[model samples]
Target: MKTEAQFENADVNMARRSFLHYAGAGMAALSVLSAASCKKDHSKPQMTTGIDIGATGDLAILNYAYALEQLEAAFYINVAAHMYTGASDDEIALLTDIRDHEVAHREFFKAALGTHAIQALTPNFSSINFSSRASVLGAAKAFEDTGVSAYNGAGYLLKSADYLLLAGKIVSVEARHASYIRDLISPSSFADSTVIDSNGMDKPQSIAQVLAIANGYLTTKVSAINYGYKAY
Candidate 1:
């Protein structure tokens, strides 16, 4: 028969294991709760300074992408809220879907970047006549095309393979948005020579090039001085 001391030691070990198992589970639950809280909390400190997407590194690239996503999300949200005159039911549904996707993209980067994420940007759409279908779709085309090119151009700058993979996934979605917008404006022009070269490859715009175009629609500016981009 086992001694009483041995029995007690066995009982202590079993109790310790049980405690650890529950503790591990608790930590996992806490992690999920923390992520949810981060996503739900939208009130971030207001920033008055222009956005410097960092000098160089994965964080800079991620921030650059984040800034673009923020602009696109804001634009799409407004478009959905005050849908253009003559917008078909199908058009509203599709535009709303685009808005949701952009919001998800924005939130994903915000969560992934955590403490390093840039503050929300304020977009200026005074030039866009939201009530007109031509104006709304035209702006959408510009935003979507710029987003696709921005991702393509910046993909090579990411040092992390994981980040690169994520960029590729996002750019593909942006491409789809670009194509859809193109078709809406002009049927069968989705993959025209403008986006697809004779070699059948999509064109990519450098950070400087993209920011120059994007800044036209934003009150805040985005810059990548560290990436040898200046005068934007």
Candidate 2:
């Protein structure tokens, strides 16, 4: 016959063994789950060769703008570093201001996007001769005109009222830049019939149209397909 104390000891030992068994099983299950999760993560697709700006959402629009700003900022930075010869004092001052504005716009978008901002793009200005006044101003005019048209076309796509307001402000400034550059290229051509319609409305281009022109000057090809915008 077993003593009472011995019986109690046997019960305690069985209980301890059972607890350890369940604990070990739980740990093994957790390990299996962790492994499965990691495998799923690894199997996910990565960003492809071209820059995918992403589809659907306010973020996509923001990223689109961010990419353009990056391009403009890079161009202005390069031009400011080595200004064209025979540039007037007024031209230099205007270009400097434009550079600062573009830099500020780039930084603003980056800060707003935080972790979602696209990578800095590499601009191909090989076609532009920075030493020549005509080439430099011509390039600037193209960029500003494109920027304004881009904003105008994309403004309706924004979901947030605040974002629309902010875009309006920026586009107005872009228009100013475009006007200044246009006047520099040809006297009194700022609001000419070429850029504005007979009704006096600024012309707008779709994302595809804008990106097609922009890609010619950018090493990184921007793809708006992910954002549901048609590819050029």
Best by lDDT: 1
Which digits, one per residue and each the tens of the lDDT, describe model 1 over residues 31-146?
A: 45445545664443333347777653676788899899989878877787788999999998998788767766776666566676778888899999989999999999999988
Backbone steric clashes in candidate 2, count: 1
Model 1, runs deviating above 4 Å: 1-49
Query: Model 1 — which ten-residue stretch has the worst lDDT?
Result: 21-30
Pairing residues by index, what is the TM-score of model 2? 0.79
| TM-score, every prediction | 0.78, 0.79
What lDDT score belongs to each candidate, Candidate 1 first? 0.77, 0.76
Q: Enumerate residue pairs that collide in model 1.
A: none
Per-residue accuracy of model 2 over 95-194 as CA lDDT, tens digit each: 8778767766776666566565688787899999999999998999999999999999999998766677778888999999999999999989999987
